[model samples]
Target: MKSYKKIAVVLTTLGVIGVSGCKKILDQSPKANVTPDVLASAGGVVGGITGVYSDLRNLWGTEGFLYYTNLGVDETLAGGGASNGGVAFATYKNYTNNVSDVYNALGGVFNIAYQDINTLNGVLQYGVAAFPDAPTRTAYLAQAKFLRALYYFHLVQTFGSVPLHTTFINTATLSDSRAPVADVYNQIIKDLTEASAELQNKPGENGSPFAGHAATKASALYLLSKAYLTRGWSSAAQSGDFQSALTTAQTLISTKATYGVDLYQNYADAYAPANDATNKEDLFAIEHSTDTKYGDFTPGASGGKINGWAYFFRPNYPTVNANYPASGGSGVMTRDIANGRPFFRVRPNYDYVNNVAFADRSNDYRYWNTFQTTWIANTANITTPRGSLTVGTDTAIWMPPYDPGADKRASFKGVIFLPPSVAAATTGANASTNTFFPALKKFDDPNRPSVNDPSSRPVVLFRFSEIYLIAAEAAYKLNDLTTAANMINVLRTRAAYRTTGMPANAVANMQITPAQVTLDFILDERTRELYGESLRWWDLTRTQSLIRRVKLYNAEAAPNIQDFMTLRPIPQTEINLVTQGPPIPQNPGF
Candidate 1:
């Protein structure tokens, strides 16, 4: 409902201001009002597009979006320090259709998405006259359409059958109706198809005047492949949906060099903070920086614009002494920026951490690379119950991949946290208890201003490696096991350990044969490759595995997850605002 009011203000008062530097294209300020006549100029068009990019920060790295995409799934649980705001989503307890009953985060996404969709509509419609050059106009329009499709894709995947709005709304409108799921997918596919044709091969190609972080032809193709893949699993599925998805993904994979995107040689290198901006594996990313003007969060501001990715997945490492006392001293490993700020909104599921993704720990280096297994002492020399510990030389806390027996653990100088299974059995802690599991290392930002500050790192939304998984899944659905195995092997091979002492055939040990390809394998492979990237919920839902998977692997959500929960309830506020035409109906069973 707020979108209606916000849309009006943005269309009437939003202005065009110039900016410079690397991310200057997205650094525009909406300070002065631009009338309809002025909106036909080049500055106005670029500024409008920049506004659309700014809106992405609202969904990509924020807490609400993080919770919506990652929680209540098989891979995660609500952490010990999780706020009450996200409890309903994590536990599936008291989850109602009312926006106020659950936290406003879910509804906030709907509102923000629609607001941006409307703004993009205006940009596409009015900005046409802004560019007289053929290629320039087409590229601008392509960017807008690509973003519009992406917003709708999120809406459709989350809420299902969301109201399809293609035209700009300059005035308040009280009437809106949800379109059929098929029609919404049709529009998404159409927009992506056009965008794929018009967009540049790469972002800022050939020194062309394009936003450094703008969507490109590869981004469009990647999304288009996903659209077709998702449609293949829906009621709107056509005979060629799977084949089309496979074809499109293969095209992106085959022409990766042409699109200026490719998988990183090592999975660890792909997520290193140093490579955040220049990672070739990233097909599209939402940009954030240390500069307060361009980054989401202000330097010392409390909570306005910040990326919570660095904080949310973290465990309470600072309190490790309380749960598993350090042999040396309490201050052995205090909180630091290198260890990440532990907001503890969500933690990995025990099943996901120990038994599933990292089962092959020796052969797959991702197990060690993906998590911080050891905490080195940050304090000076101190003597305690067991031994003397020195800074940077001794281990303060060690969370081994597998449980070392009680005798083996006690022999170690520092505290040794057992595997989740052993720890749960010994301490009577459940999966949601957050008993100092290894923190996810992918989002850790050591360069943050302070231990408590949110990260300024750009969130990589889509990667070139995902295209292989998409193609593999589509291939499996189409009964092409050979292609599926081959596609998966590409990532699996890359994930193999290449350490000095590792086996020479580590990569070969990681490869799977055609007979090993299956739906479950693909899902598990996705977890191995893309966990905590905000795609698990959508992946399971697309495959109709959410209810089953949650019940099987997630103890917190098992009891309450129902078949009808796949589609989130349409926010009651939006339904209540419909004073004209027939009222919108909420999703069934909400």
Candidate 2:
């Protein structure tokens, strides 16, 4: 096995976070030795703590675990169409207990999590003593503790009863056992509560292009509140966890100005590529940059481009380099680098667009702001063999899955041939072959240095709107229906488009009453508000609604829905690597 000292040398050489113009938290000088004594210096402590954060970005950015967390939920489904056939990610869309694939797929999630936790453990043990001033030492320790808690939160949520490594045990040991779920949540709460007390309440310096990009009092508090809500629903939960969640959320709302966070008035502005720095809605986000040379935490990857989320959600159409007029028609469909290279990993469930989006709601800008239903061809020159000879007739590709009468092809006058239902628009004999589901255009990067590759859009980890939802849910759970309705109305009213009209987004007619504050209503509201935001699977799992929701919406995941499937199987490779003590057991079913 490789020595821990060797690993430390490599990590030190990598420097800390690659964010430019940020505070100098890393020591640039080459280190000959990285013992605990050497890390006792202030610079060393900063560098060590920054290294833990770098590990977090690497893990969250490219890790399959991040993708896995979004899979097989009610709101989203796998890419099962012809385009994404035979892909590795396509297989993971549905749940599987294949130990070997599970091991290989989540190696980064498991390994990097421990790597980050262990790094924080080192900083906690050695760095605290390194700082001479009490305030500085407390601040540094607070950041480390906050991050450690965040990482463990992900671990416990993904793989239940994960091994809790709180200290830096220099010597390798194989006897580590799985900590209880309640114990893991306890550690998370402890870390976040302690960190919130020490860290500044306001957002950090202009570290990246967005607010909430760094650890702060607000971020710690937000996560602590969420952790409490999660723990409150568990089998070994405490009595007042719900009350604690409600109180924390209430405190954040009342002190929003002190925290310098608020929901953006316009939903689209929150994700606009040009407005990241000005948007105050983001509570926590992973910062990426335009410079590829700064390097990435993930091994062998080199781009600051924001390709992962965009490409995964892009539409695979018009085969590469197929010019516009020849691809569809002049007025209908066209493809360009701006359209993105789609692998179709996560697509919207059929009903997500129809039943939820257009069922009765009107002027809900979220549907239009969050998704791309129309595609315009970038190129005009008909370079390839002009398959369908119609120029200037078809302009764009529109997949109105809800509109049964949408045209698949353009005729002489650009007339649409409407189908009777959504199934007719997407499937069977008359369905258009171009029936690629609506791509999540929120993360689309038109400013990427390279069009075909990834772009550097900051991944939002938490936003202020969620705090409202959290408060609402907590209040409802506590039987304070009035508070719950008021909390939810904030978002509902924000969603409204018209002051006085028949059909308006979240208008008075659309508002729910205190009696309507049910768990199902909250779930639906979350789905509408936070769709494709990487929080769905965990949300369902915590509520114990995974089986029911998946069965109701996803045909593919329903049959495989075993109760034990709620918790992921422990990767077998991890257990196999334990050469010294009792073996780690796999999750119940697998």
TM-scores for all predictions: 0.93, 0.85
Per-residue lDDT over 178-200 for candidate 2, one digit per residue giving the tens place of the 0 to 100 score: 88998999999999999888886
Please give the range of 10 consecutive residues that has the lowest summed lDDT in model 1: 11-20
**Model 2 — TM-score against the truth?**
0.85
Write down the worst ten-residue block by lDDT for model 2. 410-419
Off by over 4 Å in 2: 1-34, 80-101, 205-212, 295-307, 320-337, 381-394, 404-435, 498-506
- Per-residue alpha-carbon lDDT of model 1 for 38-104, expressed as tens digits? 4567766666666667677777887777777888898888877765656777878777635353547
How many residue pairs in model 2 have overlapping backbones?
Answer: 18
Q: How accurate is candidate 1 locally (lDDT)?
A: 0.78
Runs of candidate 1 with Cα error greater than 4 angstroms are 1-28, 31-35, 97-103, 300-302, 322-329, 381-384, 424-432
lDDT at 375, model 2: 59
Top candidate on lDDT is 1
